[model samples]
Target: MITPSVSDPSPRRRSEKSRSATLSAALELCAENGYGKVTIEAIAARAGVSKKTIYRWWSTKGAILLDAVTELVASGSPLPDTGDIEADLRTHIGSLVRLFTSPVIGPAYTGILAELLHDERLARAVNDELVIPRVALVYQRMRGAQEQGQLPPDADLPLAVEMMYGPLYYRHALGRSYPDEQRIETLVAHVMRALRTPAPS
Candidate 1:
C-alpha cells in the first residue's frame, strides 16, 4: 500500500497573505496612478511578489482591482443592522456615502464601477459580492418588519432597496455632495412616510 502525506494548512494562510499583499499593492497603485496606469509588473513589484504568482491568482488587472475593492469594503466598513428599519437603512446609506466620498476610495470606486459597466464578469462580481449582500440585509430587515405588521405586507422590497440607495448614489456621483446627518434624516422621514401611506387599490 502506498502512504499518502497530509498537507499543512499553513500554506493556506501563506496563500491568503500573498493574495492580500497583491490586493493592497493594486489598490495603492490605483489610488495613486488610476486604473489605466496600473500594470501587473508594478503590482508584483509593489507587493514584493513575482509576476507569475500574481498571474497564478488573477487573470487580469481588472480582476486584481475587483479583489482589492472587495477587500477594502470588507475590511473598512461594517454594514449597519440596527433593529429599526428606517434608521438602519439611513445609517447604512450614510456609511456608504462616507465611504464613496473618502479620498482613498472615491476615485477607485468610480473607476471600478466604470469597468464593471463594460465587463460582465466584473459587473457580476460587484453585484454579487458588494451590492447584493448589503441590499439583501436591508431587505431581510424590511421583511421582518412586515411580518411584525410594522410595514405593509404588500411592500415592494426591490423598490424599497432602490429607494434607499438610488438617491444617495445619484447625489454622491453626480452632485458631488457628501450626505450629512440632515440629509439622511430627511431621506428616512420620506421613506417612512411612503411606507406608512396606503397604496391605491
Candidate 2:
C-alpha cells in the first residue's frame, strides 16, 4: 500500500505550523542565548525549517523577535482596569517590570532596543505596533481616573504615563535595577502619590 505524501496537507495549515514553530524557536534561542547571539540560521535550525523560509517571513533577527514579543503581549496581558486607577497602575507597571526582567523575554527584548536605536523601521514598528496600543490603554485608564476625581482634572496624563513607566524601563531595560516586592510597592506608591487628588480643606 502507498502512503499519502506529506505535501497532501493544506498549505495554509503547514504554513501556520511553520510560523508557530519558527516563533517558538526564536523565543527559545533568545532566552537561552541573548538576542544579539540569535541568528536566522540558528532559528531555522532550531525550528526545523530552512533559512530561506525564515527570510521569507522576517527580514532581520530583530523583526522575528518583535513578532514573537507582539504575539506574547497580545495573548492576555493588557493593563487591567478595576475602577481604581492606583490599583491598576500598580498592577500594570509592576507586571511590566517583572516581564522586562524575566529570564525568557527580557533578554530577547533588550537586544531589540539596540536595533531600534539605529533601525528606523524597526523603531517605528516597535513603537507604533507594540508600544502605542498598550500605552493608549493606560491613557484611557488615566482619563477615567481624572473623570472620577482620583486624579487632578487638569493632570498631564500623557506626561504622567511617561513618568510612570520611564523609570522602570530605564532602570531595568537600560540601567540594571531589579525591583522586588517592596521596591515595586514603593514605586507604585510614589506614582499614586503624584497622581492622587488632594483632600478637601
Candidate 3:
C-alpha cells in the first residue's frame, strides 16, 4: 500500500472541482447572455479558470453547454417506477415541458440546440450527453413495464420514446409553443395506447 502525502491535492479531486466550476460558469453565461453570445473567454473569466482549462475539457461552448444541460436534467427526479407507467410517464414528460419552457434554462437549451443543427459533432455530443441518458431511463422503465405484461416483448421502445418527446423537441425547436398539462396527458395516453400489448385470445 502506497501512502500519499496529506497535503497533496489529489488530481482527480481538483479535476472534478474544475469541471464543476466550468459547467456552472458555462451555464450561467449561457443563461445570462444566451448561448450565442457566450465565449470560452467569458466562461473562463466567469469561472476564474483559464481558457486553456476550458479547452482542455471541452472542444466547444456547445459541448460545455450540453454538459450543463445534462447536469441540470440529471439533477431532476429520475423516472418513477410507480407500477403505473402512464402516471410515471406523465410526470416525466411534464417535468421536461417545464424545463424547456423555463425562463433561464429554456433559452439556453434552445440556443445550443439551434447551433447543434449546423455542427454534427456538437449534435452527437448533445445526443450522447443529453438525449441518450434520458432515453435510457425511459427504455428501462418501458422494459420493466414489459416484464409486468404491460407491453409486448417486441415493443418499439425507441419509437415510443420519440413519440413521447419528439413533439416537445419540435415545439422548442420552432420556439412557437409548449405543451400544457393537458397536452402532456394526451401525449402520454397516445404513446401508451400505441405501445400497449394486445390482449391474448
Candidate 4:
C-alpha cells in the first residue's frame, strides 16, 4: 500500500488529543495546587505533552486555566427559560450556586479571583471569557422579560442583572454558600419585585 499523504488525519487527531489533555491537566493542577502555585511546566508534565505544545496553543497559564473553565461552563446545562421570570431567575441562581460550590470549578474560580488583584491581564481574560458570557445570558433573558411586560420597559436591565447576581458572588467571595433554596428563592423574589414596573398614577 502507498504511504499516507502528508496531510494525514492521524496528526490532526493527535493534536486534538494533546489539546484536550493539556486542558484537563491544567484544571487538575489548579484544583490540586491552587492557581498561584501551578505552572506551565507542571501542566506539561501532567499532560504528557511537551512545553512547546502548550505554548503553541496558550500564552500563559492563566489563559489555559480560563480555557479549562470556559470549556466547563460552556458545556454545562443551559439556563432555564420557562417564561415565568421569577421562577427562571431562581433556577439560574440555583445553577450558579451549584457551579460556585463545585469541588473542581469553585476553587479554581476563587483562586483566579484572588490572583486578579495582582494581575490585570488575568482579570481581563477572566472577565472576557467567564463573566461576560454568563452576564450576557442573564441580560438576554431579562431583556426578554421586559419585552414580555414581566418587567417594566423602563427597568434598568443591566443593573437588574448585576443586582440579581452581585450578592451571590459576594457571598461566594466571602466563602459562604447560599445556605438553602429558601434563601435563594427569597432573594430572587425580592429582585423580581424591585425590577417590576409600577402602575401609572
Candidate with top lDDT is: 3
Cα distance off (Å), candidate 4, residue 112? 0.9
RMSD of each: 3.5, 4.0, 3.0, 3.0
How do the residues 20-122 of candidate 3 rate in per-residue lDDT, one tens digit apiece? Answer: 9988888888778888899999989888889888889899888887888888888764688999888999999888878777765786799888998899998
Model 1, 1-201: lDDT tens digits are 454345444667777878989988888888899877889999999999899999998888888877776666665655554666777766666777777777667767777777777899888888888878778877887888788777888878778778888886677556467768898889877877788787899
Q: Candidate 1 or 4, higher TM-score?
A: 4
Q: Lowest summed lDDT over 10 consecutive residues: which window, candidate 4?
A: 1-10
What clash pairs does model 2 have?
none
**Model 3, residue 165: what's the lDDT?**
82
Q: What's the true lDDT of residue 133 in model 2? A: 85
Once fitted onto the true fold, the runs of candidate 2 whose alpha carbons sit more than 4 angstroms away are 1-9, 197-201
Pick the TM-score winner: 3
Instruction: Please write out the lDDT profile of model 2 over residues 98-172, one tens digit for every residue.
Output: 677777777878888888989998999999888898878888988988888888886778877787777766875
Per-candidate clashes, comma-separated: 0, 0, 0, 0
Distance from true location, Cα of 33 in model 2, Å: 2.1
Q: TM-score of every model?
A: 0.85, 0.85, 0.88, 0.88
- At residue 91, candidate 2 shows an lDDT of 79
